[model samples]
Target chain A: MTDIIIAADAWDEDIEGSLLTWIYPDGAEVKAGDVIAEITVEKLQVDITAPGDGVLSHAINEGDLVSKGGKIGALA
Target chain B: MTLTADQPATTAPARKVVMNRAIREALDWELANDPAVFLMGEDLGKFGGVYGTATGFFDKYGEDRVRDTPISEAGFMAAAAGAAMSGMKPIVELMFIDFMGVCLDPIYNFIAKHAVHTGGKQDMPVLIMAGIGGGYCDASQHSQTLFATFAHLPGLKVVAPTTAYDARGTLHAAMRDPGPVLYLMHKELLGLGLWGTMPEASSNVSDAYFEVPLGKAFVRREGTDITLVGLASMTHVASRVAKTLEGEGYSAEVIDLCSVVPLDRKTVIDSVRKTKRLVVIDEDYRTCGVAGEVIASVVEEIGTELIAPPQRVAFLDTPIPFARPLEKFARPDEDKLLKAAMRTLKHA
Candidate 1:
């Protein structure tokens, strides 16, 4: 399984981003580099892309606060 | 240009952006494409707007085009009206919707009445952008979605967009229109990561220029059980309720009334015709507001055809209290919307 990570280096390490919503539904088939979820860090909104082509599984619920480098979802 | 579903798709890739960025991009496009387009508001130039919607515009467009006006709503609003009459398109930002009270004369008397007063000879191509809604503890003074107040007046077009896609398209459409348009942006949906985040508010918006035509109602979800009509923040609420009800074996059609002034009666009536029930959720006040207006229109069209009495979930007539819990109670929410939907279904 390839894990979808909210890259730690994308924003300031001190700020925790909230998973705004999952663009694609859980268990849907997705391709590598396809945007699957959106997160808001401070005032910036960033999209999380799939790491590989596989069935997507959500690791975090929408509106949940997410830390940098944490796994938001996984592609199986 | 007005964009419809039947229109040919552009090759431009869709980018996921917050509502504020989407608005900024639309304004940027208008400013770059048309020399007639310019911006004026308090803190718009240097401060980049209170919500950061105009960030970097001051530098990119310079002081001449991106102007910073004094904290005078009446003054700037009048100036914008005069500028529009003279063939210049001015986009004025009223920091908060609640402040409209201080500048009603200019908006109602001059800006809205210009075209009509001139026998269609003069055109008022002015766009008034304002921040509205109350999710954070901004009290009654700072947080009131007063789109209905403007909609009540004649000769003005009013629009409140729920998502980034609609925000970009509607703003484009509003800017291009020959008359004055009030574009109300809900503070909670601006994607500033303030108060709480609304994931659905952020969407994949196109980079290309397009217009989500005025006087159009977008059916966000198609269903047969009941029709839940909403605008601005309430659109998101109704959508959430619809999704939740889907799992409970109930189908609810969600209609986002993007343009309030025109009141998309046909779409709402059509949906109610199919569902045989109606529920309107509005952040605006219950009395003499969009909720009542929608229900009245639908009832006037097909009152006897409805399977059940329609329900309205909206803000209380009282001012939005300062306390968080009281504000929560006053505003239309998911629970309130769900209950209203369920009630409509039960009546049917």
Candidate 2:
């Protein structure tokens, strides 16, 4: 399975910010480049988008902390 | 421009007192005094302020003035901007300053940029209030002091009152000021220690809402040896260090940038020029912070006046941790501030 793993900001040593909220849920089909989730790193917030089109699964839930290069979710 | 309470074409009067209570009291008085003044935010009303700040205010002023909103900082903050444009003074409180990440767009895009966005003349009278820093075990989510986020913005007037006296006074000024005001109340400053406990707070505050005036800096302690520029709560710590520095025969000037947006650049630059040395203290980390801006401004305007490179005594570049020791390690204390000051003295 090809995994679309979302990475964190370049400056984040660890994935410290949470996935604020997900615009899409697990098993949801999404188009490429669709904003799937909101991420907060060092008080800087950015959106995590779908890298590819397929069944989407969220690796982190709302308020759940993740690390840099950490998989926020996957499009398989 | 004085707006009246509950009556049209009437004017509210002004009075003086400690700073902390000024904003809420002004909000209360303004809401009571002005029919246009209303408050809406997360846990604002019955929670009597998210910090029990507006305690017993709703009872006296009614729910309209003391509104309790859903846990939607972005929604309410934006709504506040809209309300102000619609002719209401809405005091919007973000649950915590760290939560700015959730709702900054409305503040930055809609409120702050509105005047320019509207090509000037349209004013937003929204006063966004919330406390930065942790009361105790608030940990990362609640503990961050992110005034630098607001300070970095051009249109937002960021006010951090170190004492109750300034808190109340500056708040009064913010409410009356003709733009968006970020009125941050520190969790520690909530109980009114500067002028004694709440209820017995500075009797100097008046029922008549007055203006504290924006873009003004307060020189808490005056000295000729060195100049220290501190923004918000860090100003308090800077004041403490200044006292110790005085004991060491070094006189320092503690300048509080009451309104960060309209930074009292004259007060700061003039002080730096006189002392020939400068140290900046900010709660945010060293990089891209208020200190960075202050240092740049001083160097750009009067680089020749420096005794040495201006020093920044700032929080270590790290997230505020849960442990006391770790938190202390991250934050700038008296020792670090004094050390930075002493190092700057070498330049002179």
For all candidates, state DockQ relative to the true structure.
0.21, 0.01
CA lDDT of each prediction against the hidden true structure: 0.86, 0.71
Error of 1 at B311 (Å): 1.0
Global lDDT of model 1: 0.86
Tens-digit per-residue lDDT, A1-76, candidate 1: 8888878786865878888767767787778887777687775667688788998899889779998889888889
TM-score, per-candidate, Cα-based:
0.85, 0.73
What is the C-alpha lDDT profile of model 1 across B1-348, one tens digit per residue?
A: 333333324442344667877898888888888888999999899988977778889999999999999989999999999899888999999999999988999999999999889999999999999999898898999889886888898989999999988999999888778999999988888877775557688887766687888999999999999999989878888888999999999988999999998888999999998998999998988999889999999999999999889998999999999999999999899999999888879872
| Deviation in Å, model 2, residue B57 alpha carbon | 2.6
Displacement of the residue B175 alpha carbon in candidate 2, Å: 1.6
Q: Candidate 2: how many backbone clashes?
A: 19
